[model samples]
Target: MSDYQPKILSGGEHRSDDEIMADYGVSEDSPLVIMELLQRFHVKDIMRSRNIISLTRENTLREAKELMRDNKISGLPILEGKRLFGMVSMNQIIKALEGGWLDDPCQQHMSTSLVVLEEDIPVSIALKYFHNYTFGRFPVLNKEHEFVGILSQRDITSALLKELTSEISKLEGKTEAAVVEQRPVENVKSEWVIPYYSLRQFVIVRNDLANAGKAANEIKRMLKEAGVNSKIVRKVAVAAYELEINVCIHSLGGSLTIVLDTHKVTIIAKDNGPGIKDVDWACQDGTSTANDWIRSMGFGAGMGLSNCKRVADTFNIKSVVPTGTTVICEFNLSA
Candidate 1:
């Protein structure tokens, strides 16, 4: 039987939908099934408790700004006796200042067209709200529409990451058990079969600054849990993070995969791109194609690929003019 599989690169070259399904042992109908299961996760499952910081309609813009600064938060829910009145954010503060209302009450400057979330609603619903609006946080209400807590993008990400980690761990356990049970005793004794296992996960890398390095962080966590050497894990983490950030800052968007085996860890990052015009120059230090916006965020210092190569045991890159770019980095476990 041939090991060749079809490659689909509509957006990127990481993996096709079919490839993802095969990797996870899911059928064609599995997407709907998975979404149905995901819908069972309630907002409360991921939301912070009711001890959240909030503002009041009676509070002045100055006070609200001070509260936001003190809490290191971007927004706050405005409440009156446990009832949500409005939402106040830095945008509101700036608007108030422009209108000479810095000392005025929050209600006068707050946004009243609230988009509140229910505690018992599916987290999928909250995800839609997040995709549709630019709000940093949404006020959460209970059955009586009373203020409870707030849900932010960070909260949802943390919850989903935990769920994914748990699922992957369970899958790895099952795979290891199956391998042990199926291998012949003679083969195990001789170590001819290598007794090796592999795991692959696909991660989406967006060009958003707020979400950069998230995939690499999760990969590091998984490697640590899998008993990889701390020194090797750190090196892999540095390379993975640099490559991940490179995809975010330079490419339009991309997919990254971390493949783990008994002896090696491989990271493959593929991006929809205006491919590199000069690979040699790109590999050199202080060579950058990033824009001013990315630089202002303390990124795009022209060191991503070079730094990644420095930490990786082996590295290779391929690119096409208008098609895309792919980078493969490998780290040896037994080294």
Candidate 2:
């Protein structure tokens, strides 16, 4: 929260497959392969859809609390015939008890200011939702806007770990027997390095929404032409686009510079004056200082830095009030 000091967050370090599986550590902040998996998997793929514990609006608060206790859950969606009405949390139950309103209908005490997710959303976006919102679980709806399932962090982590273990084992050429035996990843001392070299800088004009993504698109094209792995290219492209748009909207003006080499692709965004006051707060998802005009154009949803950090192998941000800010996103290519 310091205004003068830089805030840095790094993840997606090239960890061995075994370490990832042991901790079920797959996340949006994981490596290129894991990030790709998140993008490929939808919310429905990991959401709890079967035998979901729910209560109807007509149900009393006492019944809601009983269902939560019996199922060992903290929240329950208020639904009637697959149609979601509201949500009741454990806190509401406690309050009802203290107020002697435990026998009241759930609809009278349920929380209506709900944040929900679509069943078709990617796990990557779902992770962003989890980071942005404090809700322990999100109700999922289908194309017809009917309540379908509930998604939790636990569901995503467990599903991603299983997918990661299987994919990594296959990529490492581990035999079926070795994989079944849970072979140590340290035994495989190998790495694949992609040789590449490029450097480019683009001048971004302030409030230039029309041309904001040009630089990032060029970067994506060059990487594809260079034959970089699709997954790796995707991560770099996403980070690049987010950074490019950030520079265009946030600062008076700025420049985006991209460097590609044997080890990784680095995207640096440097802006003019009017630096951020709290770099730490700015990095968090759903934190924004954007004006209404910018938000109306869909330019600042506060996902810029968060998206860059989620996809980049390493992310760094620095700012000095009235001086400007610089953000660097690096995507590792090796291992």
Candidate 3:
């Protein structure tokens, strides 16, 4: 056996909730429509499940380096009979070459402090991880803890960009006059609306992309069922979706509460920790701390907060650094 000590999470830090959220928070640049797309897809939808290049613990570091070079990948997971033991990154290869241990087994120097994504998580949450961490790729696992695939920023970006382009094309196909006519309905308020009431809460899991916009979709569906105006439903749905995504992407974990009364619909998204540093800055459109990878995936555009604010008749946000963030968006039902 090689004498090298395995390094913990050499690819990225095991960050605290506050640290992670503070590094990157809500943004307002990407179209709110893309928010739906982000929620529509999951990691399994875009992850590279086939032809995944991986290695065994007993594989030599020299072989790992050669595979990385040939494949132009920066990292490889070290497996022990389908179990993820650790990862071997390019940094480890350099150190091995320098230390004259290139022939050693991968288990001797692989990074064990790993960051992984669930196969079922929404692509939106995965995009956030790519923004927050420096790792070029993350190993994906199923609920059974079985390694299923590999998720790369490039693959996600390519897939989302294609969808975004297609969506944009559809939007552009509509005439300006048609769009202008639709705006009034979105802004309209009616005193003649039927009374509707409900209260519900949804658990928002940290990095749980698999169920990212479920709350919003549920809220939208419920409101429509309750006979709410289409315009009011759209606004409430947009707000709920943005906040829900924020909690999923930024918070350690939290809950989304939706209150529907006769007069208005209120959505409150509150998270546990990893809060924002500057609430004012975070609310600004096109202001985001998301890294290049996230931007490439059409997220971290700094429009999440702004998107919510733009549609809500009442909007309020309160945050404490390293603690958490709470945002409320209310849409008046009565004009």
Candidate 4:
């Protein structure tokens, strides 16, 4: 009567994780046999030989679709001369078919944008890039943006599993590094008023949402070192980032004010861009003017205003079309 259920997941060693299965159950010869099989076989060990199917900007969408069907390919790497430009696939073409009428250049239906990575870059880096864009494949590039080859989801997943197998072997040998114990989040009480020395006009022109988050984290670290606690810092971060993304997605750009005092915290964002035409509609969930690029990054969920409202005690948005928008939020520490 072991207290553990086999299907139940425990943090460390569940009833049957790799370590538990390897150390307690697997035959010594089994691991070696598996390793040999992986080395002798598996796509990860070999240079990928998948034929590179591609399209040009000038090609008609019909031609691209025909190539995909005739060749039994799911994706295509788009190119201009020898330079890797973007990528398109059957999925996007289907989406276009369902969403709108399509009779134009491949560039119109095609995703003429991509975030390429170096050929030698780690698969982990490629995976992160994949998270930001819903593309089936990517053109591998050299330093000069020259098309070297391409990477696919199939290759990336195989590499991940291969690395995983090595780790399983390490755990079998009892040579795994000791992991640091994690403390509970409740163990930490959020602090207020993170004092800062170099706090000035932080004009963060964030093109990427991830960069916006990073800038906020750096500011939090600065404030924490100055004696601010985690709670107040997170409020500032949420308010600051929502406003920042509002600028990145909808506005030109904006500056933030990180003013800290004994009683309150204020964050202000001002940007020049397409001001919200209808505040009531824009504030509704799932309402957004974000393009595919912005939507892919997990923004434009129409949650920005709601998020700000939840975190900031006072939230305000004022805008004029063809002019600019201003979002002001404040948190009261005294409460």
Candidate 5:
């Protein structure tokens, strides 16, 4: 194969070569270092546990803000009994504030459903979540659905950054903001807007991820049934399958909403997992945060996100912890 590599975007993240390895909380020098670090530190020792600030749905708006500031936290889990009701972060609170609903029932205003991580889960998983969503922090929960604590991206980044800088300080090292370099597309519309629409949404289950081929075949059939052109259908099917599997493997559980029209296709994916914290690094090839379980499936090799970017004519992502995330991708249709 030719060594020539065209510049292409990674998932949503774009980081320099050095920064990428560093950002993932992996050792800059060797893969073995990452493995060793992961094994040495269990989730309990590494995860920020206990006194996780929480707000009940019955709590007041003022109370939520107070808890966040008092804890110097960005988000808080909303719990009711032994269940994770939802999450409330400064952003959600701000949305309420901006909407002029300070008196709105916190129950009415707070997020009612949330993405969570178990207490004993691996810290590397949390680190990967942070890397995927570029989150500042993610809420933790116990098996009993008790609020455990929050895993702050800052904490992981700080430790990771320190590790990188420390090593670089002694050797050849420097911090770069990372670059998403790609040749500019020419003679085509790079940007387009979906006027407005809605679609039937489906959650990509773990089972489907395990059998993506079958699922992909089914999706192709669905597109045909929907009357989409073969070329357009292939694009949508591939992109949909890749992204759907990405969620099943990466994010907690995300939705795939199919917006169809005589002239276009819009697929929206909304997730409750931590938002993509690093938009740059996720786009790179050969960079992934998948666990052995996912790797065993022969997926999660940092190619899913990149594949989505390639197949979709347009894509958009909006995410916030405690509030959940949304991804909207569009495909052009021939008249």
Candidate 6:
């Protein structure tokens, strides 16, 4: 593993919540969004098995180095039976060689002041630590504080990829159904006093990153042309963008429909699923199941639903495992 470097927090250098939010282009008041996103994911969900490669305090630096090489791993937990002694990494081995302590016992050089995660804690906490620490992995402890397993960034990312694949399958199934229902329809006149005409448009979203945000951008353009209020248009635009990105990143294929009338605008997103296993959890901010690839593209912070909810006057979501998901966001023009 790489050498662990601690982040320094100096006086007058701390960033405020608003500053952090602005840095990320998120709303300043929505810190809970991140918390909600991470609440559903537990450490156990992403931790490697307890049968991890380890070493003993009595082991020599050369042995530790050889073990790491054989296993092709960067860090090893030092343990006495089930109890953790400390942690040793490849960097420590290099340091020991430089200091002519290559034969010294690992306990003398291993890092004892450890940062660890609880088995049941949210993975968000782990993510936070990963952002703050330079360690390649963290030791996981159970309720009794016994070392249970180890978690790495790669493990969390792998779990997310699996979830994304499952969701995409569900979306593909929904796309088949959507095709059957996708036919020409006549517009209905609104009963409102404003004598409004309803306009509806349907766009297909595929899992093509190249065209991810096209549908939402087009929706925004259409709303603007319809003379919608600027504030309302921005809200719809943001919601549409998030939903469209969700389809592109998480679904195999799906459809987004926009219904605009004098009184309100409705955006419906439906996709085949290995649908969401937990609707409430999915709706929380900062709770995303997107893989590392999606995150690498600067997306999938688990804030899609939260952002949509924040802007919409009314929001409804339905999802079923192995089936599909449907999200409806309504914006009242009068509001």
Q: What does the lDDT read for residue 2 in candidate 3?
A: 33
Model 2 weakest 10-residue run by lDDT:
1-10
Model 1 clash count equals 0
Candidate 2 residues 39-107, lDDT tens each? 568999888855788888889999999988988999998887777888999999999999999999998
Candidate 2 residues lying further than 4 Å off, grouped into runs, are: 1-30, 174-335
Off by over 4 Å in 3: 1-30, 176-335
lDDT of 4 by residue, 1-335 (tens): 11211121113222333344344233334443233223233222322454477778677767777888898987777676566556677777787678763455676666554555565554433444444456566666655656766666777556646766764564443222212111112423234333331233355443434346654665576567656567977877887777777775576555555656566677777776667789888877778877544665577788887788888889888889878777888878665
Instruction: In model 1, state the lDDT of residue 276.
Output: 90
Alpha carbon lDDT of each predicted model = 0.72, 0.76, 0.76, 0.59, 0.60, 0.74
Q: What is the C-alpha RMSD of each candidate to the true structure, in Å?
A: 20.9, 19.2, 15.0, 20.4, 24.4, 10.1
Q: Name the candidate that leads on TM-score.
A: 6
Q: Candidate order by TM-score, highest to lowest?
A: 6, 3, 2, 1, 4, 5
lDDT of 5 by residue, 137-204 (tens): 66666656566666676655565556545544522211121111111124323222223432444544
lDDT-best of 1 and 6:
6
User: Which ranges of candidate 5 are over 4 A from the true structure?
Assistant: 1-198, 206-208, 211-216
Task: For residues 159-184, write the lDDT of model 1, one tens digit per residue.
Answer: 87787666456446644654553343
- Candidate 3 matches the true fold with a TM-score of 0.47
- Of the pair 3 and 6, which is ahead by lDDT? 3
Return whichever of 2 and 4 wins on lDDT.
2
lDDT of 3: 0.76
**What TM-score, over all chains together, does every model reach?**
0.45, 0.45, 0.47, 0.41, 0.41, 0.49
On lDDT, the stronger of 1 and 5 is 1
Best-to-worst lDDT order: 3, 2, 6, 1, 5, 4
Candidate 6 lDDT tens digits, 34-63: 333345569998788878989888998889
Error of 6 at 130 (Å): 0.8
- lDDT score, candidate 4, position 115: 54
